[model samples]
Structure formats: structure tokens, C-alpha cells
Target: MDNHAITTRGLTRRFGAITAVDSVDLDIPRGGVVGIVGPNGAGKSTTIRMLLGLIEPTDGAGTVFGEPITRPKRYADRVGALIENPAFLPNISARANVQSMATLRGVPSDRVDDVLEIVGLSDRADDCVSKYSLGMKQRLGIAIALLPDPELLVLDEPTNGLDPAGIVEVRQLLRRLGDEGRTVVVSSHLLSEIEAAADYLVVIRFGKILFAGPLGDLLEQERRYVDLQPEMESEIEDLASVYTNAGYDVTIEPDTVRVVIDPVESANLNRLAIENGFVLRQLIRSNENLEDVFLRMTDANTEVAA
Candidate 1:
């Protein structure tokens, strides 16, 4: 079997004149959570649909468990997906909804109970889906996906409509699934949630990959910004101008200054400040996370488009 649980090469999908998903490549390994993040209309959903074989790609090809995605039966039992907001039989109970999935997929009857428990829906398993809260319904959708006990789980906006408590619950569930040695892929527009839940991230913009790797490594690659806090407010502008005159991007806040500088520039600025007799009370280098990277990349794209 291929080591990668999911692999896509030049995946592209078009809707007549508009290209919903452009050429994209991704490889998700086993036993880890890979977060897919992008702005609205950035092809995150389109990519998920293509991966599930729900929509055929206009160009390129992909595989789930090394089997052609186009041939769903080849790896259908090994892949579980909550493509989007799932449709349920509102009149029936949550457990029944999952049982229906098991029936259609020829999954074992006992698996429904197991998945409901896994998603924390066992307490209200018998509750009619119509009466369940949005968060509960979301869990039911996941229960349906897990009925087959697939090795890979794909969740798109799993926290959508979830309350704060529900969000935490879902995050914990994803972490637990990863601990059990199952490959997980989560797609969301919320970078903060991704930062907390995902180990690695694949950030896409305008349907193209902007970055792909461990979250920590990506932040390390970007220039570090130093936040400086000083005692005197009146002298802050002068201190900022000192760096700005030296060609650094200096952003001054109420009580802090955000100085974006490369390593070489950082060294020079530090030396220059001391030489000029500026008392620097505090200075700390900041390594930005996935959220910062996402904002920078997406904002740059917007500027280019404008």
C-alpha cells in the first residue's frame, strides 16, 4: 500500500468559465492531521469534493489509499468523509441515521454504536436528529462517516455552527483520532482552530499552494518581528523613525512597536539603537504562527488582485 493515505497531482476542476480548483498537489501521510486552509473561494471546498470523488477533476488525478479516487469501490471502505454539512433523515434518531449509513455501506451493525460513542453522541443517540442541536447534528454526521471504521477521516468545517464547548470537543476528538494512528484531514477557513488542531498545514490561495509543512517550521521560515516596549511614550515615534529611516517596516502600537526585520537587519537596528543612546526597555522576537502566515499570504493575494 502507498505510504500516503491521500495524494493528489495537478488536481484541477472547472465549472465552465470559472476554474473552481486549479492545479494542486498534496500528500497526506498516515497518523497525522493535515489542515487545509484558505480564504473564501480559495478552492478549499472544491479540493475536498474532488478528493472524495464527488466531483471529477477537469485535469489531473488523485488517489485515496493508493487506489484511484474515480474508482470509489477500490478504497471506499478505507476512507471516511464528512464532505460538508451532511443531509440526514430529520424524522429519525441520530443512531438510526448512522445505522442507515451502515446499512447502505454494508458496514457492521455494531460499528454504529462504536462511532456514536467516539463522537460523543451516545448520550443523545436516540434523540431525533430534528430535535438535536446543530453541534449534535454535526457529530451525527461524523458518526455516519465513521460507521465504516475507515483508516482515514476527512472533516470539512467540522466546527461550523458549533458552540465554544463543541469546538473544544471536536478538537479533542481529532487529536484522539490522530493518537490512534489514523490519518486525518481537516479543512477550515478559521486559522486559529487549525492552529490548535492541526500538526501540519497546507495553505492554498487562488487554488495554488502557498506553503505546506509543519506549522512551526513555516513560522520559523518567515522573518521574525520584534515587539519593543519602552517607558516613554513621547520618544516612541523617534525610536520608530530610527528604524524606519534604516529601511525596516516599523509599526507602532499604543504601548508596543512591531518591527519586522530580517536577521541581518535586526542586528544592525539593535546596534544602531544602542549607539544613538535610545533606552530599549524590552525587546522580544516573535515567531508568527499559521494565523499570521495565512493573513500575510491572503492579504498579499488581495493586494495583487486589486
Candidate 2:
């Protein structure tokens, strides 16, 4: 049997004439945290809905637990998900909300308290959900998702509206969950969160996957750059031109030159700077992080289309 917790083959969804989720493929292995990141309206939520079988795809197929997604038996027992804003009875306590979901899923009653503890809401379990802050409500939603103890957990914008402390709590919880060998798929627009928490990532733009791989591999030397500062302020633009003429793509910021140098060109940059009589004050190698790459790629794509 396939060990994948989630898999999609050419999944597509459309609304009238507009394509909300284009042909997209995803494979999430069991017992790992895979992050999905994209801009607003980039189809992250649409893709999750298709995986949950809440919306049928316009074309192609997907599977959860190695069975076709359309089959409730395939996904029902193995997957727990929180997509978009989760609803709750305003008058009920946080614990009560989780217990209701556990009951609906036929999960044991004791699992309610277990999930509350996992989400760190045991102290406030008796407080009415309406009285809970936004972060508390979000944790309650997570607690509901956890109650079923499924093989896979999928959360959409799980940290939305959370304060810094709440964000840290959720991040730690996800790490703990993954360490325990549960497959996790967390979607967010926040690159920092993904960088700090996810082992693997799928970056999307305009409903299509731009890259999918290990986070470390994606941020390798080829995709990195350097920020160069010149000792002489007057020679800043001159140094930038020197780098540019040597075929390095250099962007002049207010006081530094952002240089995109490959393996071969990177070595040449240092040697050329010394030879050209420009004193290099700083040469800090920076991984043009996923966020930077996302912005650069999308902007170029937009400019080209325009």
C-alpha cells in the first residue's frame, strides 16, 4: 500500500469561466510537515477544499490514504482538516466545542480533554467561546481538528489573527505533532512561519506550483545572493556598474548593491572588486529567501504578461 497521506494528480477546479485552482499535483508523505504558501487568491484554499472532497474537481483525480478522494471511506477516517474560518456555537465553552466535534466523529469523550491539553486551552476550557480571544478561538479550532487523531492534519491559515505568543504556541504544537509521526499540511501566506516550521514546502503563484522541494535544497547557493557595501560612498554606483558589467545582476538599494551571483560569478565578484580599485567594506552572502524569490518571480511574471 502507498504510504502517502495525501496525493493529487492534475487536480483542477473552476468557477464559471474563471479557473480558481488550475491543474495542480501534490504528494504529502506520512509523518511530515509540508507547508503550502502563496499570495491571496492564489488558490491555496481552493486546493485544500478539493483534497477534503468538499468541492469536486473540474478534472483529474486525487487520493487520501491511497484511495480516490471521492470515496468517503478513503479520506474520512484518515484526515482531519480546518479550512477557512471554522464555526463554533458562541455560547459554548472551548472544551464544549471540541467535545461536540469529537462526538460527531464518534471519537471517545476523553479525547476532548486530551485535545484541549494539546492546544493549551485546558485552563480556559470552561470559558465561553464568545468570551475567548481570537487566538483562543483559533486554538479551539485546532483542538477540534486534533480530536479525531487522524493520520493527517490539514490547517489553513492556522495562525491568522494570533498574537506573537499564540503564534509561538501553535508553531511549537505543530513541531510536536510532526515529531510524533503525524502527517501535517499547513497553509499560510506568511513565509517566515513556513521557514521556521516546515521541513518541506510547496510554493505557488496564480494557482500553480512554482517550486516544491526540501526547504534547505530550495535555498541553496544557486538561489542565493549577496549584499555588497563599498567603503567609499561615492563609488557605490561605480562598484554596482562594475559588478553589472561583469554579468552579475545587481540592484542598487539606498546604500548597498544587491548582487545576484552564481557559483562561477560569485568568485569573480570578489577578485574583480579588489582588482578594480574598489574597497569592499562588506560582502554578506544572503539566501534570497522564499519570500524574496516569490516577490521577484511574481513581479517578473506580471511585467512580462503586461
Candidate 3:
């Protein structure tokens, strides 16, 4: 079997005059969660749809489990997907809905109980679909996907419209699934959720891939900063000049000064401040969060396009 669960090379898709997904290359491994992030209209949905064989690519090629995407049946049984909103018979019980889906897929009905337990919905298995919360409904969508015993699970904004508690619940579930060695691909607008749940990331912009790699690697690429507040507000300008002369990006505020520097240089920064007669009231290092890094990348891409 291929080590990669999914791979695409120069995959492109166009709708009339608009290119929904440009030439894109992706290599998703067989285990762990990979988060795909992009601004609206960045082609995330279009790319996923092509991978699932719901839409054909206009150029290039892709494979799922080493089988050509065009021949979906070869790998379809091993994959499960939840894209956009999950549809269910609103008036029916969750169990009945799962049973009906199982019947259509020819999946054994016995798997329904197992999937419900995996998604933490076994207790409410008999509840009417309409009565379930948004989070519970999302869990049901995931349960339906799990019925196939898929090796690869694709979820698009699984936490969309969820409350904080629901988001946490779904995040933990995805982590657990990846820990169990299942390959999971998820897309979300929630950067913090993605940072917490995904081990790897793929960032896209304007229908093009901007970045792809381990989440740690992406974070490390961003410059760290030191936030400093002097004992006297008047010293802010002098402190900014000191860091600026030392070749650092300095942001001066009324109460604090933020200096973008390597973490190792933080001690040097403090030493210079003291040497310059600036009494430091507070000095704290702040790392760039995932949202910050994501915005920086996308913004850079936008500038380049301009």
C-alpha cells in the first residue's frame, strides 16, 4: 500500500472563465490529522470535491490510496467524507438515519453502534435528528462517514456553527481518530482549532497553495517578539530607537514596545535596555500564534499577486 493516503500533482479545476482550483500539489500521509486553511473562495471546497470524484479536474491528476481519483470505486470504499452541511431526515431518529444510510451503502448495520460511540452520540442514538444540537448533528454526519470503516476521512468545517463546547468536543474526537492511525483531512476557518487539532497544515490562497508542512515548522518560520514596558512612559521612544538601531522591527505603543527578534536575542534586548538607562517594568516574550502566521502568509501572497 502507498504510504500516502492522498496525493495530487498539478491538479486544476475551472468553471467557465473562473479557475476554482489552480495547479496544486499535495501529499497527505496515511495517518494523523491535516488541516487545510484558506480564506473564502480560496478553492478549498473545489479541491476537496475533485479529490472525492464529485467534480473532474480540468488538468493534472490526483490519487486516493494510490488509485486514480477518476476511478473512485477503486478507493471509494476505503474513504468517507462530510462536505458542507450534512443532510439527514430531520424527523427520524439518529439510529434510523444511520440504519438507512448503512442499508444504502451496504455497510453492516452492526457498525452503527460502534460509530455512534466513537462520536460520543451513543447516549442520544434514539433522539430525533431535529432535536439534536448542531454539534450533535455534526457528530452524526461524522458517524455516517465512519460507517464505511474508512481509512481516510475528509471533513470540511466539521465545527462550523458549533458552540465553544461543541468545537472542543469535535477537536478532541479528530485528535483521537488521528491517534488511532487513521488519516484525517479537515478544513476550517477556525485557526486556533486547527492549530490544536492538526499535526500538519496546508494553507491556500487565491486557489493556490501557499504553504504546506508540519504545523511546528510553519510556526517556527514566524519571528518571535518581546513585549517590553518601561518604568516611565517617556522612555518608549528611546527603547524603540535602541531596538531599531540594533536591526529589529519595533512597534512603539504608549505603554509597551514590541520588538520582533529571535527568541535567543531576548536576553540581549534586556541587557541593551538596562545599559541605556531604561528601567524595565515588564519584559515578556510573545510567540506568533497560528492566526498571525496564517494572515502573514496570505497577506504576502496577496501582495505578490498585486
Candidate 4:
């Protein structure tokens, strides 16, 4: 059995002069929540649409569960997707809406209630979709996607238009789904939301992938620095000079000098500073968060493109 839920090679889509998705390759491993993040117009949605067979690729090839994406019907039944807002009959109850969808998909009607419970909408199952909040509507969309009992679930900005609480709710729901052994691909512009929900991340910029891997691995690629505050503020520059001469990137502040180095090399940094007669007040590792990593990678890509 293939370990990947989704895979693509040279997936490209062009709109006359504009390339919405450039030559891109992606590997979405089976199980766990994978987040696809990109700036506006970075081709996140376009790539997803191609993967779901909603749009045909202009070039390249892809597979969902090892079935060719070009032959969508061959694998469509095993995958479920929620792209943009789910349209439901405004006057109908959530349950009825799901039932209609279940009917269309040939899913067992009994699974409607099960999906409703999965998305925390069982209590409001009788409420008309028009009366439901944006968050509730998103949940209903997810329930509909779940109706197929899909092995791979693809969601595009599932938390869009959601309030803070709603965002948290959706985040937790996606995490729980991944925990239940479903492979989930969730696209989002919000870095914080993805950090909280996803284990693996794919970051794209200007229709090209900037970074893709386990979140931890991406963070690890970012250089860790040791922040050192010396008792004598004037010694900051001298310490920075010493570290820079020793092949480390050094940033000097009012009372501290930050040197980019591995955590294990902190002892060497301290020794270098003490050898220069500068007493240290504090020494700590500055860990880069996901936002930092994302910004750095995307900004670097922008620079390269320029």
C-alpha cells in the first residue's frame, strides 16, 4: 500500500500570461493533519482544486490514493473535499441538507447522524442552515464531506470568516480527525491556526513551494541563536565582533549581543565572551517560532525572485 495520501509532480496551471501554480511537487503523507499555507495569490487554492479534480492541470500529473488525478472518478469516491463555502438550502434543516448530500453521494443515510456528531452539530441538527452561524455552517460543510467516509479529506481555508472561538473549534476538530487516522490536508493563511492544528506544513509563495516538511524539521532548519546580555553594555560590540570574526552572524543590541549558533555551541560563546573580560548577565537560546520560520522562508523567496 502507498504511504502517501496525495502526490504531485510538476503540477502547473497557467491562465494566459499568469501562472497560478508553477511547476510544483508535493507529497502529502497518509494520516496526520497537513497544512498548506501561502500568501494571497500563491496558488494554494489552485493546487488544491487540481488535486480534487475540480480543475484540470495544464501540465504535470498527480495522484490521490495512487489513482491518477486525470481520472478523478477512479479515486473521487475515497476522497472528500470542502472547497470554499458549502452551499446548502437555506430553508432546510442541517440534517436534511446532509441527507440530501448523502443521497447524492450514495452514502448510507444512517451516517448522517454520525457525521453530525463528529462535527459537534448534533444538537443543532434540526436548525435551518440559514439560522446557523458562520462557524456552524463550516461545521455542516465538514459533516457533508465526512458523509463519504473519505480516507483523505481536503479542506481549503475551513476557518475563514470564523471568529477566534470558531477558529479554535475548527482547529481542534481537524486535529481530532487526524488523530482518528484520517489524512487531512487543510489550507490556511493564518500561521497561528496551522501551528496549532497541523503536524506537517507546506508553504508556497508566488505559485511555488517555499518549504514543505514536518513542522519541526522546518523550524530546525532555521538557525538557533544564543542571546547574551553582558553586565557592561559597551562590551556588546566587542563580543559581536569576536563572534562575527569567528564566522557567526552577530546582531548587537543595547545591552546584549545575539550570535547565531547551535545550542551546543553556547558554552564556546560564553567562553569567548568571558575571555574578553565581559561578565554575562544572561544567556538564553532564542527559539524561532513557526511565524518566524514562515516569514524568513517566504521573504527569502521574494528576494530571490526579485
- Give each model a TM-score: 0.84, 0.85, 0.82, 0.83
Question: Which prediction has more favorable TM-score, 1 or 2?
Answer: 2
Over the stretch 102-153, how does candidate 2's per-residue lDDT look in tens digits? 8789999999999888888899999999998888888888888887797789
| lDDT by residue for model 3 (1-306), tens | 689888999999999999888999999888999999988788998999999999999999999999999999898888898997877999999999999989988998889999999888999999999999888899899999998988899998898778898888889989988999999999976577788989889999888998888898888877688899999898898889998988888988568999988777788989999999888999988887778889878988899978
Model 1 collision count:
0
| lDDT against true structure, model 3 | 0.89
Q: Give the per-residue lDDT digits (tens) of candidate 1, residues 1-306.
A: 688887889999899998877788888777778888888788999998887878889999998888887887788788888877867999998888888888999988888889998888888999899998888888888888777777888998898889999999989988888788888899888888887878888888888877777877776766578877665767788888888887888888778777987544555666777877777777777766656778888887777767
Candidate 3 has which clashing residue pairs, if any? none
Error of model 3, residue 253, in angstroms: 9.1
What are the Cα lDDT values of the candidates? 0.83, 0.82, 0.89, 0.88
Model 4 regions lying over 4 Å from their true place: 226-247, 250-259, 262-285
Better of 1 and 4 by lDDT: 4
- Model 3 poorest 10 in a row by lDDT: 188-197
lDDT of 4: 0.88
